[model samples]
Target: MHVATADQHTADWLMRFGLVRSEEHLNHYRRQGFAWMVARMFPNAGLEELCAFTDLNTLLFLLDDYLDHQESSASPENRDKKVKAMIDGFIRVLRQPKYGEQSGNPVFVALAELWQRMKKMSSRSWQRDFIQSIVAIFTAAIWQHENVKAGKWPLLADYMEQRQYLGAANIATDTIAVVDKIRLPRKMYEHPLLQELTALCRNTVCWANDLFSLSKEIAHGDYHNLVVLLSHEENISMEEAIVRACEIHDDQVKQFMRLCRYLPNEGPVMKMELHRYVEGLKNIMRANIDWSDYETSRYQYEYEEHVRTHKVREHYLMEAAV
Candidate 1:
């Protein structure tokens, strides 16, 4: 099965990252340590490249915020610190003038403008909409660029003429279709020609979903209770929860690896590798907890202790209760 292979690949990758030493370790890492590791491990590529394409740092930061808020007894000050740290990192990356010693990446230019606009938006809904719009635009541009690079000028022209109609539709879905439809002159996926770019696209989609989920959690202030809620919803034991979390983390890592195979020679290989490192860091968080030792009734104490030590703050406790 595709899922089984993906799961096995993920597990092996996690082991290499030292993220699955034990169930207890997994829990601790997931609850408290993951965010810090992710923050430290994010890719060092310029902001322009990241914004133009899908990069992992933004998503990791979003997840870090989610975990910080979900821990019981998370403090207001701690939450603010995490948010500030994330924002500072974003600004640091974005302020850099030179990205990859290249020029005339229109997608990068568009993304810069979108990021600037997003930085100015105060409304959460508007910000989400803007991000979605930017992603759609970027996807379209990438597809067009791919066609041009492949020497499919006729198709490129066709796409340009239909751009307005296509732009009004869902970009991610449309781009996927475009990728499927394109007739490569040769078997491209295995050619080692566009491996990095392919991987970037795959990683970008996964990262985008991760970001979307984290943003939803933060906007609703439901971070602290997410794990407990997931356990309850699945009607699984704490041990089972740990197992599932490890499994999910592993799958994500494998997907990243698969994406790496699609990169072009000039693409950001280091950047993608750094993204994998962040994945390893997240696995560390998942590996630190011994979920099997705790009874359902003991969730509160374990969670509270985790939160207190982690300096979590400003979660929507009452809202999450519902």
Candidate 2:
């Protein structure tokens, strides 16, 4: 959300395009344009709905500022070219004949495609933010679908958000099969054909976990104690622990696949797959000393001490205020 002084050339172009009538209008246009792009790309969901579903109101606000900065700072010619490219891509998707047939599902498919295109146009930080945001959206969709299927609408308001509910339901009902078939803890992760797929999934999950951890930290103004306990016992940095987790996930998948090739393809493949993966996971757990009782207990104690100190500080502050 940093801004640079506008160069004369860029300022002239903005004047010509009438993009910035004044500094006050910059944020307004940026939000409007971004909202337009989102709506045009994902016609099924409004700005508020998308923000709610992804829980990304903060990020969207940041992105609005970012776009305004880019518009003000970047060269006029470059800005025009980039805008044209975005418009052209949008038009191409919209004007395509037999869109529904080509995409199978127009709403999600088109938005996913447009997201990838826009991601390329954004800065590196923005690209990462976009990926994280999409992952959040996808996760929310999955959660909603499961809630509906369970027939226990925990909150009636969740069900009222039709696009998110339906979109999540569709992904869960359709895409879950493909994901489930991949068989975690199976040897599939090690297989040449499936290695890339497994790696992609592990990376995606890790990214999601990182974001989840960040949110937890921000909410509590403190790091999660469980993670601290794990890190201390593992004798590794948090980043290293995350990497190891990803590695372990990939390894478990590979081992599972190796086990699968041995099993007879007679009865339930999923049942057999789980059995093999669980056996491999047991082996992995045994190999990691951090998973042992003594070290884990020590770390847990340390984490509790850390949390207790924070609680004591808060108690003293409240007493002083009173």
Candidate 3:
């Protein structure tokens, strides 16, 4: 299962970009084990590609923190306005042909640098796909926030459909080409079986995340996870919901295997690229599991002290939620 050798390359790259301004932020980043997760997800990645991958992951983590904590705490009247502005600003930065200094937001600035680097490093279509995937994520977060505030959780079908963006797996898949320097033919990439394979990979990763973060989400009064949604919508107990969530993840894995048996036929070069992409997805799913299992900081109550505990009881570290 140790698909990749561990390295501190990405952790070191954090400072090179000067993304974290304060000692507090710096300490938080170090504690996150973000770089290691990226490396695991992209087992064969070179230093430069791994660093870029980790940077995007870290940037998204910061944005999610802002949404779930800071943006959520704002008054309802201000929350919607602020979230939209931030989303729009980020979208503009990502969609732009070149980096611009319009937004003072640190995340936006970091993203612009990333966009430039990705533009030069990846194909034009890959760049477009990445932007679209990220934009969907931001937009979906905003919608989810509004739905929760309105006390209206979506139906299971709708939720599953929209969760694609929340998981941000499209961007993760797109990274294979840039990081591995291999490109699958567009037709093979778009084939239905390949799409199903990708959906299974994305679902497994997101569902596992739902299980891992269930307690934290509950304690924060956030109930957007599949586990929470299932329990609430189905009128089932939390224990039952967790079991159901695991079943969904397992079933997806089974389907992933079935789909992998019949991947699209393509030229040798394209077949190799497709194989690499599939392997990349498998590694990403495994990385999510590894990260949640080992890196307790994100879910741990006493992250600084390392109690090796879990869950989101009120007595837990309220400060860690942000």
Candidate 4:
């Protein structure tokens, strides 16, 4: 997480303004590097704008953490019902698209505030797209909860499809447009190339996440991950599953590079817009690894150390061959 002088000035103000009641909660959220990532994504943003961007990510991360895993004493059935209600609350915001903070939940208040800024900054169509992308995340998170309850591992394709939304890549990139003032015309936005670009970034970032978070998820016995899903589908050990996951990341990245070469060469302004969008995608890819590697405590250095160990990989491959 690269912290600019501008970003450094804004960090304390953003934290104080956006944090909920708990001191511990605020500390945890800051530790996740949400503000740092926002500073990178919207490098040109002034203090207020950067704070707003960071607030959305902070709320989203906290919401995800609160909802995804089992932390409460509620029964499985009750937990599912609770998850449904939380997801439905966000879905209602999309369907109705309200302003003014009436909800008691600070998360909803934060989202409402974010939505207000978004509506002011971007087109209605973009807003719709952003909301829909966010809704996809909520829905997929419900799927995660349901999967945990049912004790069923989805196939690799299905898992990837869901985790793409979980990565929130679309929301992240589109928000970049608003914060950075990248005025990509609808034609460019709708182009197959751009869609491919977005999807590839989404896939790669999420799968990199799957790699970085593998040990954490494994320790929790969570199968809502690319590596674990592949392992199940291929009957491979964790190491081999990791090797396969790396292949997925490599393939997507190569496709992204290939597609970058073919991005339409047009007017100077349009080309620059396309270039900015591509750079935003790259920021996402790099930020995920940077945050995972050093910025966040959720993933352990020991996990990465294990990934680098040839013995584990070789042992798994040898066993699989036999």
Cα lDDT of model 4 overall? 0.70
lDDT score for residue 286 of model 1? 28
Candidate with the greatest lDDT versus the true structure: 3
What's the true lDDT of residue 29 in model 2?
Answer: 39
Give the alpha carbon lDDT tens digit for every residue of 2-114 in model 3.
21222344444456556666668767876777777777777777766766777788777777877777545778878778878778888888776344455666667777876
Clashes of each: 31, 9, 0, 0
lDDT of 2 by residue, 132-184 (tens): 43444444534533443343433323322332222222221112122223254
Worst 10 residues of 4 by lDDT: 311-320
Model 3, residue 255: displacement in angstroms? 0.7
Q: What is the per-residue lDDT of model 1 for residues 1-322, given as tens digits with 9 covering 90 to 100?
A: 1222322333333344343457664444344322222222223322332222121222332334343443334465664465444434333334532431122432233334434533442244434544454345444444443443343433323432334322222322222212122233234334543433333333333322222233344455432222323355667864454344334434444454454444444346644543343343322222222221121111233222433232221111111221
Whole-model Cα lDDT of every candidate shown, in order: 0.34, 0.34, 0.71, 0.70
Predicted structure 2, TM vs. truth:
0.21
- Model 3 regions lying over 4 Å from their true place: 1-21, 97-99, 301-322
lDDT of 4 by residue, 160-213 (tens): 778888767667777767767788878888899998998888888787787877
TM-scores, in order shown?
A: 0.25, 0.21, 0.85, 0.85
Clashing pairs in 4: none
Error of 4 at 1 (Å): 12
Return the candidate ranking by TM-score, descending: 3, 4, 1, 2
Task: Please identify which of the two predictions, 1 or 4, would achieve the higher TM-score against the true structure.
Answer: 4
